[model samples]
Target: MGIVVNQSIKNTFITFVGFAIGAMNTLFMYTHFLGEDYYGLTAFLLSSANIMMPLMAFGIQNTLVRFYAEHQTEEEKSRFLNLMLVLPLLLVVPIFIGLALFYNETAELLSQENPIIFDYVWMIPVIGLFMGYFEIFYAWVKVHLKSVFGNFVKEVLLRIFISIFLLAVHLNWLTSIQFVYSLVFIYFAMMLVMAFVAFKVRKPEFHLQFPKDKKEVLLYSAFIIFSSGIAVLLLDIDKFMIGQYIPIKEAAYYSVAIFIALTISVPMRAMHQITHPITTDLMARKKHEELNQLYKKTAITLQVVGGFIMLGILTNIHQVYALLPEKYSGGISVVFLISFSKFFDLMLGNNNSIIFNSKYYRTVLLLGLCLVVVTVGLNMVFIPSFGIEGAAIATLISIGLYSIAKLMFVVFKMKLFPFTRKTIISLLLIALTFVVFYFWNFPFHPIMNILLKSVLLAVWYWFLNYRLAISEDINAVVKKGLKFNTPR
Candidate 1:
C-alpha cells in the first residue's frame, strides 16, 4: 500500500494536469480555433485509431505483465521479454500491408456517411500502429515497478503536443489537414521516447528462443487480445459509430461531453497503473486472501474518489454547459449518463486486471466478446434514433451490464467482492453531498461559481469521510497530510 499510495497520488495529479490541458483543448481551442466539422473529424480519427490499437498490439502489453512476474531466472525472463516484443509484429505487419493495399477502399467506406473523414482516414492505422507499440514499451517498464515516468509520458506528453498543434492552427501556421498529419507524427514521437525509456529501464536482451511455456504464453496472448480488444471497444466504439451514423460535427459535440465526464475516471486510471502489476504478482503467488482485500480496498477507494468528481460534475454541469458554445450545448445529457457510467467503471477497481491475470481469463474473454456484439447492436439502434444522447445511453447500458457480469463472476468464482459496510455508507454520503450543495449557487461568474462550489463540496465530503474513517488507506494519507497522529 505504501508504493501504491505514493505512486497513485502522483499519477493522479499528473493525469489531472493532462486532463486539464485536454479540457482546454476540447472546450476552447478545438471549438474556437478549428470549426466543429474538423474538430469532429479529429475526434473520430483518434477514436478509430484507439479501437484499432489493442488489435495491432495483440495484447502483448497485458501478456508481458502477467508472465514477467512468473518467470524466475534472468535467462528465462529475457526469453519471455523478447517473445513479448516480437509477438505484436506478427499482427502489426500484416495489418500494415492490408491497410496499404486497401487504403482507398477503406477511406471510401468510412467516408460514405461523412465524407469529411476521407482525407484523414489514412492516419487511423498509422497512429494506431504507433500507439500500440507505445503501450507495449510502456508495459515493459511497468513490470519493473517503474510506472510514474511512463505514466507521465502516457498521460501528459502527447496532450501537451496536441495543445501546441492546436495553437499552431490558430496562428495560421498549419492547415487543418497539416494539423491532422501532425498527430501521426506526435504519436510516433511518443512511441520512440517510450522505447528509449524502456530500454534504459532494462536494456534489450533479445533472444531468438522461446520460453519453456511457449504454448501457454501464445495462448494467453491470443485470448487476451479479445479481452483487451473488448475493453478498448467498449470505451471507444461509441465515438467511432457516431461518425458512421451521424454527421461528423455531432461526434465533436459528443466528444466534448465525454471528455468532461471522463475526468471522473482519472483516479481509477492512475491507480490501475500501479495496481495492475501488483494484482498480477498477487495472482501469480495465489494470494487469494490478500487479493480479496485489495479488490475491496481499491473498489471503495476509487468509488469515493470517483464519486466526488461525479458529484461535482453533476452539480455544476448546468453552469458548465452555460459557458460552452451553443453548438455543443446539447450534450448535457451525454455528460450525466457518461459520468455515471465512468463512476460505475471506477467502482470495479482492478477487476479487469484480476480476471486477466487469473486462470479464468478465458471465460472473461468470451463474456467480453459477447458484450462487444451487444454494444454495437445497442449503438446501432440508439445512435440513429436519439442522436448523441442515445449513444451515451447505449454506452451506459453496455458498460453497466458488462461491469455487473464481471463483478458477479469474480465473487462467485474467486469468492472475492469489492464491497463492504463502508461502501453503502459512502454511497449515502455522495447522495447527501450532491443534494445539499447542488442547489446552492453563487452570484458570480460561472468559473468562480464552479470553483467555490467544488471547494466547498470537496471539503465537506472529505471532512465526513475522514471523521467516519471510510477507508483506512485514505484516512492514513489524510492524517499524515494534516500532521495529525494516526489512531490505533
Candidate 2:
C-alpha cells in the first residue's frame, strides 16, 4: 500500500501535467491553429501509427516487462534487452515490405477521400517499431522504480513539442504536411530521450547472455504479442473504420472528441504503468493475497480518481463542446460513450497485467481475440451509417465487451474479482456527483466555468470516498502516505 500510494502520487502529478499539455494542444491549439482538414490529416496519420503499433511491435515491449525478472544477472538482463531491442525490425520490416508490395492497389482503393493518407502509410512501421522498443527500454527503468523520468518523456515532453509545432503552424511557420511529419518526429524524440534515461539509470551491458529458459521467453512473447494486438485493435480500429467509411473530416472530428473524452483514462493509464510489474512480481511469488488486495485497491482508487474526471467530462460535456467548433460538437456523445468505456476499463483494475503474467496467458489471449474480432466487426457494421457517432457506438459496445470478457476470465479462471463495496458505492456517488454538478450550469468564461466546476467535482469525489469509507486498503494506503509524509 505504501509503495502503490507513493507511486500513485507521482503518477497523478505526471498524468495531470501531461493532460494539461494535451488539453492545451487539443482544445486551444489544434482548433484555433490548424484548420479542420489539416487537423483531420494530423489525427489520421497518428491513429494509423498507433493502430500499427501492436502488430509491428510483435509483442516485444510487453514481452520484456513480463520476462525481465527471469534474468538475475546484469549480463543476462543486458543481453535480453539487446535481443528485445533488435526483434522488432524482423516483424516491422516485413510488414513494410508487404504493404509496399500492395501499395498501388491499396492506395488506389483507399485514397479516394484522403489521398494524402496513402503517402504516409509507410511511416507506420517506423513509428510502431520505435514505440515497441521504447516500451521495452522503459520497462527496464520501470522495474527499477525510476518511472518519473520516463513519464515526463512519454507524457509531458512530447506534448510540449506538439504544442510548439502546432503553434508554428498557427503562425504560418510550417505547412500542414510538415506539421504532420513533425508529430511523428516528436514521438521519435520522446522515445530516444526515454531510452537514454533508461541507460543512465541502470546501464545494461551490451552482451548476449540468453536465459536458459528460452522456451518460456518464446511462449510469453508469442502470447503477449497476440494480447497486444487485441488491445490495439480494440482501441484504434474505430479510427481506421471512420477513415474508410466517413469523410476524413469526420475522422478528425472523432479524433478531437475522443481525445477530449480520453482525459478520464489518463490517470488509470498512469496508474497501470507503475502497478503492472509489481503485480507480475507478486503473482510470481504466489502472493495471491497481495495480488488480490492490489487488484481491489487499484479498481477502487481508479474508480474514485477516474470517477472524478468522468464527472468533469460528463457534467461539463456541454461546456466542453462549447469550447470546440460546431462541427466537432457531434463528438459530445463520443465523449460520454468513450469516457464510460474507459471507466469500465478502470473498473477492471489490473486484470490485464494479471492475465498476461499468469500461467494461463495463452488461453486468455485467445479468448480476448474473439472479443477483438467482434469489436472490429461491429465497427464495420455501424461506422458507415452514423459516421463519428457510429464509431462512438462501436467503441462503446466493443470496450464493454472487452471489459466483461476480461472480468469473466479473472473470475472463472483465476478466481479473482476487483469489486468491493466501495466500488459499487463509488459508482452511485459518482451518479450523484453528476446530478449535483450537471444541473449547476455555469455560463461564465469557458475556461473559468470549467475550472471552478472541475475543482468542485474533484472535491466532491474525494468527499464521497471519505464519506463511504471506501476500500479499507485505500484508506490505509492514504493514511500511510499522509503519515509518512508528515515531518519526522
Candidate 3:
C-alpha cells in the first residue's frame, strides 16, 4: 500500500505537468499553428494508430508482466523475457507484411475522406510496433519496482517530444502531412530512449533464451494478444471510425472531447502503473486480505478525487470551452458524456488491474472482446446519424456497461466490493452539491465564478467526511502538511 501510494504520488505530479503541456499543445498551439481540418487530422491519425497498435504487438507486454513475476530463477526469467521480446516481432512482422501487400487499398480506405491519411497511414503500424515493444521492455523494469522512469518517459517525455515537433511544424520546417509522419518517428525515438534507460537500470544480460516448453509461451502470449487487442480497440476504435465514416475535422473535434474526458482517468493511470506489479506479487503470495484492503481504499480514493475533478470540469466546462475556438464548442456535450463514463470507471477503483492480473483473466478479457465488438457496432450505427457526438455516446454506453460488468464479476467471483457506508454518503453529498451549484447561478466574473464554485464544491464533498470522523487518510494528509504531530 505504501509503495503504491508513493509511486502514485510521484506519477500524479508527473502526469499533471504533462497534462498542462498537452493542453497547451492540443487546445492552443495546435489551433494557432494549424487549421481546423489539419488539426483534426493531427488528432485523428494518432487515434487511428492507437486503435490498431494493440493488434500489432499482440498483448505480449502484459503477458510479460504476468509471467515474468512467476519465474523464480534468473535463467527462467531471462528466458521468458527474451521470448516475449522476440515473439512480438514475429507476430508483427507478418502483420506488417500482410498490410503492405494491400497497402494501396488500405491507405486509400484509411484516408478515404482525407487525402492526407493515404500518405500517413503507413506510419501507424510503425508507431504501434515501437509502442508495443516499449511496453514489454517497460514491464520488465516495472516488475523490478522501477516504474518512475517508464512513467516519466510515457507521460512526460512523449509530450515533450510532441511539443517540439509541433513547434517545428509551426515554424514551417514541416508541412502538415509530414508533421503527422514525424509523430510516428518521435514516438519510436521516445521508446528507444525508454528502452535504453530501462536497460541501464535493469542491466539484464542480452541473450535470447526460450523456455523448454515453447507451447506454454505461445499459448499465453497468443491469448493475451487477442485480449489486449480487443481492449485497446475498444478504447480507441472511434477515432478510426470517425475518420472512416465522417470527416477528419470531426474526428479531430471528437478527439478534443476525449482528451477532456480522459483527464479524470489520470489518477487511475498513475495508480495502474504501480498497482499491477503489486497485484501480481500479492496474488502470487495468496495475500487476499491485504489485496482486498488495497482494492477498497484505492477505489474510494480514486472515486473521491476523480469525482472532484469530474465535477470541476463539469461546473466550469462552459467557461473552459469559451476559451477555445468556435469549432470545438460543439464537443462540450461530448466532454460531459465522456466524463461521466470515466467517472463511473473511477468509481470502480483499480478493478481493472486486479482483473487483468488475476488467474481467471481470460474470461474477463473474453467479456471485453464482446464489448469491443458491441462498441464498434454502436459507433457504426450511431456515428453516421450523430457524428462524433454519437461516438461519444457509444463510448459512454460501452464504458458504463464494461465498468458494471467488471464490478459485478469481482463482487460475485471474489466476494469483494470496494464499497462502504461512507461511499454511499459521499455519493449523496456529490449529488446534492451538484444541484446546489447548478441552481446558485452566481453573478461574478468567470474566474471568480470558478473560485467560488470550487470552494463550495470542495466544502460540500469533504464536510460530511470531516463531521462523521471518516477519512483517516484525509486527516493524515492535513496533519502531515501542518506538521501537527511533531514530537513535543
lDDT of 1 by residue, 1-488 (tens): 57766777788788888888888888888988888888888999999999999877888888898889899999999888888888888888898888889989989999999988988887898899898899999999988878788888987888889889999999999988788779889999999999999999988788878899978888888877777788789889999999999999999999999999998988887788679868988898899999999999999999998998899999999888878888889999999999988899898889988987777877877888899999999999999999999999999999899889989889998889999999999999999998998899999999999999999998999999999899888998987877765455
Task: Tell me how far the alpha carbon of residue 440 in candidate 3 is from the true structure, in angstroms, after superposition.
Answer: 4.9
TM-score of 3: 0.89
Per-residue alpha-carbon lDDT of model 2 for 322-416, expressed as tens digits? 87888788888888888888899888888888987877777767777887787778888888777788888888887787679779888888888
Which residue pairs in candidate 1 collide?
A: none
Residue-level lDDT tens digits of model 3 in 1-488: 67766877787788888898888787777776777787777777676667666666667776776677778888877777677767777768787898889999889877766776787777778877778877877787878777777888887888888888778878999877677778878888877887897678666655755877567767877887787677778888888888888878887678777888888998787777677768778778988898898788878777777877887788878766766788888999999999999988998877887886676678888889899889989999999999988999999999998889999988999866888877887787667767777556466776687788888878876766567644556666766866866766
TM-scores of all candidate predictions against the true structure:
0.89, 0.87, 0.89
lDDT of 3 at 238: 85
The candidate, 1 or 2, that scores higher on lDDT is 1
- What value does the lDDT take at residue 87 in candidate 3? 77
Better of 2 and 3 by TM-score: 3
Higher-TM-score candidate among 1 and 2? Answer: 1
Stretches of candidate 3 off by over 4 Å are 1-9, 69-81, 202-209, 273-294, 439-452, 468-470, 479-488
